[model samples]
Structures are given as C-alpha cells and as structure tokens.
Target: MTESSIEANYNRAKLEADKVDLLIAEALENGCSFLVEAGAGSGKTYSLNQAAAWVQENKWAEYRKNAQSAVCITYTNAAVEVIKERLPENSPVLPRTIHAFAWEAIKQYQSFLVKTVTENLDYMPDEGDFARVDEVRYTLGNRYRENGVQYLYHDDVLKLFCELLDNGKFRRMFADRYPLILIDEYQDSYGPIVEKFVEYFIEPGAAPQFGFFGDAWQTIYQSNKACGAISSDWLKVIRKGSNFRSAPRIVRLLNDIRPDLPQTSAIDGFEGEVVVITNDDYSGSRRNDRNFKGELPPDVLRERLDEVTGLIRGNVLPEETTKTLMITHKVLASQQGYDELLAIIGDALRDEEDVFLIFFKDVVEPVYRALCESDHAGLFEALGVKRYPINKKSDKIRWHELRRSLESARNSKAIDVVNAVVGSGLVPIPPKIEGWMSLYRGDSSTLYASSASIGQYLGLDYQQFVAAIEFLQPDASFSTEHGVKGEEYDNVVFAIGRGWNLYQFDVYAPMITGQVPIPSGKQASFERNRNLFYVCCSRPRKRLFFFVSIPLSLEFRSFLHDLAGEENCYTYGDFLREWPERTIAACVKNGAS
Candidate 1:
C-alpha cells in the first residue's frame, strides 16, 4: 500500500477512536454517566487511561474549583497499579481499589461503622457494645476485632456504607468531594453494592458524574456477585468495538461466542491460529455408570494435555508463548505430582473454619521454592524410604533437574524466614512424598516429620505456594484461574473437562446447543462455566486451543466448530498425527506479533 493510503487508514482508525472519546467527554461534560461494555481484548485499560487523561486535561479547572479529585475505582490492587502506571507521574487520577476507596470515603465515621457492624452484621444487642471501641478498621475477612481495632471487612464496609447512606452528611460528602467516579471492572463488583452505587449516580442530576467500565461477559471471578445485565437504559451503555490485544481470527471466535458485543480487531492484518480438538471415541459410562458420562481419567487427561501442548508448541505457538490454563485444581495437585502432599497438608492448611485466610497464607512471602532444600536424612525419614526412586533413567533425569532447579525460586525480595524448616518436619506424606522423602531420609522418623513440615514450608509465601501447587503440575508451567486473570499470552491451551464438582460442562453443552433447555434453577451453574470458558478463551492474544476431556457429542462439536470456525476443528487422532499446518508460523516470519 502507498504511504498516503496507509496514513489515511491510520487517520480513519484514529478518527473512529476519537469519536468514542468525544462521546465520553460529552457525557462527563454534561454531568451524565456511562457504562463502557469492553469486549474481549478491547483495551479496557487503555480506554480508562485515556478517559482519566482526558478528564484531567478538560475538567481540571472544575476539580480545582471544587477542591475535589477524579476517582478511578478498580476491583484489584494490581489493576490500580496498572492505572497509576499508565497515568502521568503527577496525574490527577486517584486510582484505588474498591476497599481502599470505600474506607477512605468513610473512615472518619467510626461511630456509624460500629453501629452498623454491631446491630446489623454482628447481630449485637446495642451500639453501646462498642463504647470502648477505639477505632474502626477494615479487613478482607469476616468483620471482627481483637483489641480496640474494631475491624470491618468486605461486606461490613458495604453494610456501613449503606447505613451511612441514610446520613445526610455522607450524601453531601459524596456530592461535594468526588466530582468524577470511574469504576473499572464493575462487573466483578458486588452486585447489590453496585446497584446501590449506580442508582445513586444514575439519576439525571446526580453529582460526581460517574461511569462504569467493564464487561459482563468477563465476570468470571465474581459471577456470584455479578451485576447482571445492569439496565443499559439508565446507564448510557457504550460498547468499545476495537480489540487491540487479539488477532483477527481470535477476535472472530470471541465475537462468535459473544454475539452481543462482537469486537473488531485493531491489527492491520493478523490471522492467528485457532483450534478446537474434540474426541468422540471415548465411550460413555466408563467410570461406573452414574447418569451416563465419559471422562478422561487423570492419567489419560495428562497424556492428552501433554500431547496437544507439544503439538501446539512445535507447530503453532512457541513454548514460551503458550500458557496452559488448568481449570480443576482438585486433580491438578495429583496430576501435577503433589496431590499426595496436598491431601494431608491441604486438610491441615485450615479446618473448615477460615478458608480464605489459609488461602492468603499460601500466598508466598519471598519467592516460589518448588522444592525444599531439606537434609537428605530428613527427606528419607519424612517419607519413610530406604532408597531413591531414581531406578529408571527418566527418573534420574527428572531428579537431577529437580536438584538443579531446587536452587531457583520465584522473586528476589528477601523476607525474614519465619518458621523456617530445618528438616523435612513440615511437609505431609503420602506414598509419593514418602518415596520422594525416602530418597533424602535415612529412616522412618524423617519420613513422618516430612508431613509435619509440609504446611509451614509451603506457606512461606504466595510465590512458594504457587510453586508448590504447580510444582511438577505435569512437568509443564501452568497458571491458576485466579492468578492468570487479566493476563495475556501469545497462545493459550485452556483445559476443559469433567472435573470440579462445581462445573457441569456435560449439561452446559446441551443447554447451549438448544437440545436441552437449562432451567432457571440451574442458571448459576451455566453461568459459572460460561464465564470461566469465556475468560479463558479471551486470554490468548494470538492463538486459542481447547483441550476438552468431557464428552462432546455431535451437537456440541458442531457448536464448537461454528464458534471457532470449521477450518479450526480437529479430532484427537488428527491433532496427534496429521494436525494441519499453521498459517501463522508460515506467514509471520519475524518477531513476536
């Protein structure tokens, strides 16, 4: 193409983007709010950053006159960091997580928080119970207090905010202080609180002209608390149609699944690889007939995952470019070669009382230490082993790799090694760990102590916990659902299967295909899988592959083909033996596109 034509096309695209910007600017200028439904790869962060800069450039005078700041509320601290990094050094945008924003908004109103927690959440008899309460604090867990902290929590803050809503002072504070409120990832926000927030600002003349920026389809993390179909009429809903992250082919697939908010890829000409490998030969009722289903057992599932991974890595996406999103953590521990350890230690992490705290504890401190550098004797005694499992050449090779990589860990930040394990006195023991520890241990005492040490050693930090979780997760790097949210990769191998009691892909397929109507009662189940599937599919910037282990009937196969293009469909045998050559590798010869 001629330089003139190229420049002309670029100008046209820029003009198109500017039109959306103008609309948003006009909305804010006119004291109106909007809901930007950003589709897959639509550059939600870019749009938000642009809006923040635009408001600062255009409305800084008003903000200064009112002695207020433009607030950007995000769901996660990581997101807040992204927003802050995108804005200028002294940018006017005040980006904060919802919790921080909420606390800062009403931290001074301790009496109201105490009243709300005592009467409403704690179910205490009277507000006088908190007469000795020195201060109000917020936590991520259920609301409580030890000393005079009077800690509030996720829901407590909301409850208190709701109670404070009745106070005319709080309402005026909202009207006076925050002149603009831009909420990112609003879909993942708590539904009731979102409704209350929107209702307050959604009115024609509400102050702090607010806008919500998020996609309902990307509402996997908090689907239970998802603000469903948040009435677009009240909220001037706008769809950002440009997908800056994905290739043309990936965007098409995304749009096919999400017909409501179809996106147009911004890339000039990028056709990435897209494939859906299905298996039909796996007959039904294989694992004890219980309502007719066929599932790839842990062993077979591991094999297939490895097979497809190798294929994609060799032919389509590079190993570094590919990311595997494992859906079921239940089998992951076992499949990843740590289920035995997880069995005893997982139970010990926390009793049924406080699950999230233990989850937080698993969040490593300094770095991810995949293997603990325990003394050989402790290792052997922990697992009650007399000899190592280096019988086979392959075992010897892996054992050597483990030794070399054992020195490697997650991050570099030094943390005080609290509760440091001197020996294998923390790790839980099963036959696998027992055998593993046996290699290092001299006798049974060390083998049993290994189990004792498992919990504290792994709880070193999130990095360590993640390392331990996916330790050998099949000799391949894997990403957890929570860990990989909002992250992008060149290619994604999303494993979908009949695992996790929470999801029902077997039933979801029929409902989606129109063969079996999903009852209203089961809507949540359908949404749970649907949102997760969408989130996974949209993660890959270049290529997307699905490793479905559950039964895929003819209808489901057709549905998948329709969603991912028939040219992209492949049978298990075809992918294994004669998988079609990728056009992406053939055409794009240079760097990472």
Candidate 2:
C-alpha cells in the first residue's frame, strides 16, 4: 500500500482495535447486563456486533456449542436492513425489528401463530371475530373521543402484546433460547411491550445478555404515543456519549445544548462555522387557508423551498453532498399536503446531482413500485388462490409485459395505466361485492385489498404486475418524522410546516399538556426534531441547513423556532430581506454545474 493508504488504514485499525476487548469482556462477564447510552455516529452498531461476537465465542467455549443467537432489535425496517448489511459476513448476529422478532418467536409456538384476524362488532355484525380488537378500540377511542382524540390500530396492539408478555407468553418463548437481547433506539420502545421485555426477559433469571443503544436526546416515538426517554431505572448504564459522526464544531453545538455528553472519537479536530438564518420577513399567508387546520399550504412551503434550493445551488460544497430533509413535527397533520410538496421538490431537485430530499408523502411509492417489480410473483402466490396458481401466474406475466410496453411507448406518463387499472369501467366490481378494493391499504373488507387483487381482477395473471408498476413515474424520497428515525443525512433542512401542529403525538403536545412535566420528553421531542435535524445535517458530514416554513398559527411557529435553535432560526420572509442578489444566478450556476 502507498504511504497515505497505509497510514489511513493504520489509523482506522487503531481506533477499531482500541478498548474493543474491554467492551466485549464487560458484555460477556457472568451476571452482566448493560444499558449503553450511545449518541448518533458513535459506532453503536459496531459495539453491538462486538458484544454479539463475545456472546457467541463464550457460548462455544463454555457449552461446547453455538448459542441460540443474540437478538438485536431496532424500531425501523431501514435499521433492520442496515444492521443486516453492516454485520460482518459469517457473523451470526440476528438483527430484527421487535415486531419481526415477536412474530418469529410466536411462530415457533403453535397457539401464538394467528391464522387470521376476525374483526366482529355487535353493531357492525358484518365484521368478523375481532373481539379484543373491538373492545380496546372502543375503550381507547371512547376515552379519546370525549377528549377529541383519535386512537390508531397498532397502539392497542402494543398494549395487547405487552399484556400477553407480562402474562408469561414472552418469557416462556425465550426460556430456553439463550438469546442475548440488544435494543437500539431504546427511547422509542418505552410502552408496555418494552416494560414486559425488561420485566420478564431481562430482569428475571433469563440470564440473556443485554446491550442498549440510543441517545437520550432523540427519544421521540414509543408505543404509548407519549414522549420516550432513557429512564434512571434501566440496569447498569454505560453512556457512549461522544459523537464520532459529527465534526468537533458541530459537536460543540450539540454539547452546548447537552452538557452531560460522553467523550468519543466520532469526530475530532474539525472546524466549521454554524450558520442559523432566521427568516423574519416572509409572511406565511399561504398556509392560513381555513380548510386545512394543521398543514403548511404546499404552495407557500414550495415558495420557501424554492428559496432554500436557491441557497443550496449557490453555496453547498461537493454539490451532491447536500441533502435537504423537510421534516414536520407531525407528518399526518400537515395541511399543505405532502404529495403536492413532494411533486414540487422532485421538480426542483430533479436536475441537481448533489441535492436530495426526504419528504414523507412520496417516498413509499417508489418502494411499493420496486416491490411490485421484484416480488410481484411471490406476492401473488402468497395472497392468491392455491388451486388456480397457474391461472394467477399467467395473468401476472401478462400484466408485467403490458407495463413494459407502456414504458416502451414513451412520452405518456403511467397515469394512463393507473387509471385503466383503478378507475371506472375496466373490470366492474360485482354488485355483490360490498367493498371497493383498496389499492392503498391492504385490508380484506376492501374488494381488491392488495396489488395482488389489482392483478387478479385485471387478468394480469397471464403477465405480471411488474408491467403495470413499470409505468409509475418515480417521485422523490420524503419520510415522516417517525420514518427517518435511526437514519441520518449531512445537510438536513426541516420544513416544520403545519403538520407538526396537527398530529396528536407532535412531541410538542406534551409541552402543551400540563399533565406530565416531561420537559425531557418535550425536550427529547424537540431534540428528536433537532436530532433528526442534526441527523439530516450530520448526514452530509459537511453542511446542514434547516428550512422551517412559518405556520399560519404563531404558536406553531414558536414551537418550530424553539426546536430549531431560535438564535439560528429564520423565516421565509427573512430570505426576502437579504434578497441574496445572486440567488437566481446561483440556481442557474448550480443547475448548470
């Protein structure tokens, strides 16, 4: 290797090898349990992998056999994929989401494996046997109804799962597995499910090893729909407080906010000025439309987005390194409509090589389209009739071919196919069919519940859905606040529009709710927003920008500025004040570059 290459490798090797043995030793020590407080970019995953290796090595050494395997649980599908990808080849670490792990464990036990879920209500007799689902929905909805609240489906599922585990089902499954349980983003797992895991799986004599990684600053979501935190009660806490992901200058900014941070080698000796633009001149006249109470008007936000795009085109380094993350405090409540903003941004960033965005509304379409392309056949088999499998397969193949034809046709956007498949008159729904097939939500009551139904009814069984999916015009990537957890970007710009104000779990609500004095939760929520902001900003590892569109309500605006560093904050109007003379020129230059 050349001198520089050898030196670079030596430096990385030294960091990796340093104290790695100590971490492993602690994890494997008998009667050992640890709750590690790892900040973003702190190699938390590395530590977890190291611990898993220690567990496996000890199992083989002590018992003369491989252990069941270490269980590493994270909150998001992306994290699951990341863990799986990052793990060393041939490593036996079993990283999965809590839900996936739960389902897997339940699958091993016959009674826990549910064949079907029947939702039957007395007044809604047409519904099937969702006895428990009905009760909890009624109970939670009734309580929230009087208070003007909406209860989600999985919230109750979390409570029910917890109840089952607390009652010993969870414990019984893990009784002999010798599985080491590792939790990531622990703050997001605080509901009954987590309590049950701790009480039954960790606290009891299960003797499984435990490794927890998460920042106390970024605990935004939990099953309880409340603020999440790293409680004082967790056993044997070890804080991985230093940030290896951020430059020293950025670390200083975070540390100024959080004084108790640990020291680490994530980022050191890097210097950069932190710029906070408080845009005060832009009046948010657009989002005030009375029709949508909790959304930033897409047009208004789009205007602000245009300005930020202008700045990025002019100033950001390494062009493609710049990524803008438009995060609202709440995705569901945004009035501006996520899809509309996404369509607009996709247009703005369409040509920019380095500039990318994470918007909530439009990110899933591509994934759905991709899945239909790759797994359309498997999906058909899983959901379609067994006796008529060949018939189904033939239809799917034809659909795939047709979609390919549509793309090959050129000039026409795929909306023609979408309309043909979903719109009126293609395949008339039987008058006997009570519910319209939902192309979006996969519920059985809906006549065509999944992509499978669309293919099945359209006689695509002869071809495949891949053809139909091929016609879908690709949109930009935008994730919900919840969606971007455990994910990071270098330059993050939050469009904390009206949605954050409308959503029930806005993280700012706890600050509004006097019932719980969880400033930490509120702070954590703000910090989670900030953490997400930091995550998106730190993602580039070079620059960060926050574009928080002013909301119609001053209250909402104040909440955003508070979370986004009031001193460094700016409004859309603020950009108009400076009117960077080169703004338009910058866009042209950046676009050209």
Candidate 3:
C-alpha cells in the first residue's frame, strides 16, 4: 500500500477509534458548548458515544453524581440503531429517534390522558396504538373537511408533537431531562422542531454541547430548510472529505463532475476507471419519430448489458468481483428496456463461473415485507399468487384467516395487534389456531415474508431477505450517468440508456447555464434531477463497462473528437452515427415496434 493509503486509513481510525475518549478530553478541557460537524462516513455515532462517556465521567469526578442525561436526536429509526450499536459497551447515552426523544421528554410531565390526547391529535402512534390516533385523525378529517383542510401526511404527526411542546409544561420537560444533546441526520429534521429545541433546550449561558453530521450534497432529499440554522456561519462546520466506501479512482471521477466537494484522505490508494457512456453516432435519421430518434431502445440496452456482463465475467478475482453493482434511475429500473437487459445479463451469466445476476427490483418485495411485517404466504394470497408447492386452496384459506386476525386485532385492543405482529418471527402460518396467532403477533415482519416467500416458492425458507436487498443495492461502480447512493454494491455493469444524450449541457442547457432562465418549479426539478444523476454515477469501485446505446452528446462528441487528436483512450466505433437497424428488427420481432 502507498503511504497515502496508510494515512487515509489512519485518519478514518482516528475519527472512529475510541472516539468517546477524545470527546471526553475535549469536554473536560472546555465546558463550553461544543459543536461538531460530522461528514458522511465520519463516525458521527462513535463521536456521540465518546461525548456521552465524557459527560458521565466528568459528572462522577466533579459532582459526585451522574450527568443529568445526554439526548441524541437522530433522523431515522435506523440511525437510532446505529448509535445504539456504536455506544460504549456499557455506555449510558440516551440515543433515540427525534420523535422518540421528544415523546419521552414530553410524556414524563404529562398525564396519560394528556399524552393520549396528544397522540390522538397526531396520527403517529405505534401500529398497536394507531386506532386511538386514527380515531382522532378521522374526527379531524371530518372537521377539516368542513373547514376545507386536507388529511395529514406523516410529518403532520411531528407538527402536532411540536404544538404540544409549544406549551410551557412540555418545553420544561425536555429542558430538565437531557442536559447535553447530539443530533444525527439533523439536516433532514423538521425546521420548526429544531427551532423548538433552540428555544427550549438551549441553556442561556451554558447551552448543552451539540454535535451534528450530514452532507448538503446528499441533502437533496426533502426538508432542505430543516437544518438551515446548522449551516456554516452559525455552527462550527467540519467536512469529512474522505469516502470510506468508494475507491479513490471512483471518487476522483465523481469529484471531476462535482468539483466543489471537500478533499478528503479517504480515497488515497484505490484505483479504477469511471467510464462515461452515451449514444451520438447515428448518421441517418432512419426513424424520425420523436420517441425513437437517437434514443436507447430495448435491444440496445440488452446488448450493452450482455457486453458489460461478459467483460466483467472475463476479469475474475475470487470474492473481489462481487463488489461491482449496476445502478440506474428509478425510472430506468422499472423500464421494459431494463427488464430486457436483465434477461441478457442473466442468460450471459447462466454458465459463468463466479458471476451473480442481482436485479435491483428484487429489493422491493423485501422492503414491503419490512413495512407490512406479515407472512409472504399471506402476501402472496393478497397479491393473487395462487400456485405454490403446498396446496393452493389451503394457502388461500390461511391467507384469509391471517387477514381476519389482523382485522380482529385492529378492532380489539391496540396492544393485542402489536403483540400478535411481534409474536411470530418468520414461521409460515396454517389456517389453524396456532398458525393464526403466530402469523399475527410478531415482531419480525421482514423475517416472516422472507421465509414464507422462499419456502412456498423454492421449497425452503431462505432467511436472506436482508442479504438479498443489500446484494442488489445501488453501489458506486457503474459508468452510467445515474450513480447509486446511500447503499453499496459489488461488481457493476453500466447500461447508459438512450437517455444519456439528454444530459448534454446543450440539450438541457436551457434549464441550467443557458440564456433562457428556468422557471422556479422547473429549476427545482432540474436541481433534484442533476443531484440524483450525480449520485447514481458514483456507486462502483471495480471494473466499469460503457454500454452506449447511441453514441455521445454534442459536447461529449466534440470533446471526444478533440481527445482523439491527443490520445486513444477510447475507440471510434464507440461513437454512434446511426441507430442500429437491428434494434428496430428486434423490437418488431418482440411486437413492440
């Protein structure tokens, strides 16, 4: 390994290694509220753990008692789990999701009835407790209907929670409970909610120490205004530049596109190609139709997939190739063109030694199971899947019974519903008494569907839903303009759809960097679209194959032509001057012509 590689790894370790110890050291040296800006993959949770440890240690030494409490406000339940997992073995940090933290703080000073009233007003109680809140929501819906107000989205739940906190009683509850606070993914948090914290939790002279971590680039998700207060001038800002997940070559390529990114040491020794694919060479407008002209067709996508998959299969390295991933936009993934490509890859890899065909679409079912928390057999019945290894009629009966049990629980006590869903982990249910109970009262919905789906379909329960989802996740390896984010994958194949040409600054240039100013609504859409495209192009680490359906864009074509005068890194045939007649032939043969 190079010296830079060693340094990169060391830097990563410094942020993640016994981070709590360093946090304590800093806290002991300065009692002033400390603000930390954590970047992507910068070990934000580890730092929080260290800060909590410091609080507990100093409280015992100086005050002969435990610190009042440390509150960690995170964006998601998954973030809560990550913090819990990273805390010191016996750490006392009260890590929780923002809503959970808020609820716990508010619940302490309020009566159960008051808390119940708050929950009813806001439809965010747990599944078992949904009825109480649902009743309130229904009533509110009727009242709102009379007033021309609409039903609620999930965020309205937090809005109601904030309303309750606006009352002095609940505000004091949070202030008195946790003395120090750390928030993760605070960027995605609701703005009003954070403002509430500043108003209520910020101690006048000695505010609680605060640490936060997130990236504005990836903050393309909703709620941009939420973390506005935590921006550079108001808060201490530190950028974690290194990407622990992607290889250096991949990072470099991505940086080339997004030059404003922070320079981090995380990408030191990694090397790989980041190819850009496009279709531009079509000389004749054989088909002048608006949809068909100079665009990627199904056959072209299929051919690219086969070619890309074949290239990777040729360059085998035991477990190394598993990291390559193919990522496309949500639209592309759902397209018939993508389906054809999958079939091509599948056929090409059927006899290949170590290659695996992982379709990103497969993740949907597992995620659905996670949401529903029910058996796949019941779902199959619900989805109208009749054929199974076991008797079809028997499975349908079991499905009906499971639905009946769910309705019963919904009508009965809320706890009864929770208990039933949390009871059965993953076992398939019969229509019998025990099966109905097992299927309903269970904590592991993901497990139940995964096991049931594989059992009935493949004759063996495969507890691999999580693995499968991860395996097919978006990764940073492909050359397609759309790169994956928030997930990683191995072994990527790039299938630049016919839409690649649309990325030319000259094509969509009017929306950005052009004389014609974009409309505000269209401007927002373009920004989001650009951010998403950039995210998708950075998901691979290994070999990259360019499967261009047409050719190159106007700017790209000019650039390539200019480059041809200086170097030969690419091929002339890679440029498309004419749409392949074969595509039309194939499309007609498949009856899509």
- On lDDT, the leading prediction is 1
lDDT for 86 (candidate 1): 78
Models ranked on TM-score = 1, 2, 3
lDDT of 1 by residue, 1-593 (tens): 86655345334444656677677777777767788888777767777888898887987776777688889998878878888887777666799987788778888877776655555545332323344566777765445565666666566666566666656678778768887889888887767766666666566456767788888777776434567557746667778777777777788877776777767666554466677887655553344334224667667667777777777776653444777777655555545544544554564422322222232234221111323443555445444457753468875455445443333433311111221221212333235433533443443233233354433333334343444434433344566554566888888987766546666555575465455677889887887767777788788877788777776776677677777778777778777775645443554452343
Each model's lDDT comes to: 0.63, 0.46, 0.44
Considering lDDT, which of the candidate structures 2 and 3 is the better prediction for this target?
Answer: 2
Q: How many clashes in each structure?
A: 32, 56, 50
Tally clashes: model 1.
Answer: 32
* Residue lDDT tens for model 2, 551-583: 324554454344345654545565445435534
Worst 10 residues of 3 by lDDT: 352-361
Which prediction has more favorable TM-score, 1 or 3?
1
RMSD of candidates 1 onward, in order: 9.2, 11.8, 14.2
Tell me the tens digit of each residue's lDDT in model 3 across 1-593.
Answer: 66665576547645554443464456445644445544444455555566656655655343324346676777767867876776665454677776566545543333432354544644333323223222223212222211322233345445666777677765555555555677766656677876765555444433454656555445445444554325333344444445555555555555554555533425333344444344443343433344334544545454545544544444444344433233333224323223322333332322222111222123223323423665656545433456542357875555455445545554443234334443423223234424534544443232323223211222211222222223344432222233244544444444433333234332332333233456665654565545544445444544343444454555544432332222222332442212233223432342221
Q: RMSD, model 1, all Cα superposed?
A: 9.2
List where candidate 1 sits over 4 angstroms from the true fold: 3-15, 88-91, 121-131, 139-143, 146-148, 222-224, 281-285, 288-293, 317-320, 345-476, 481-483, 509-520, 580-593
lDDT of 2 at 556: 42
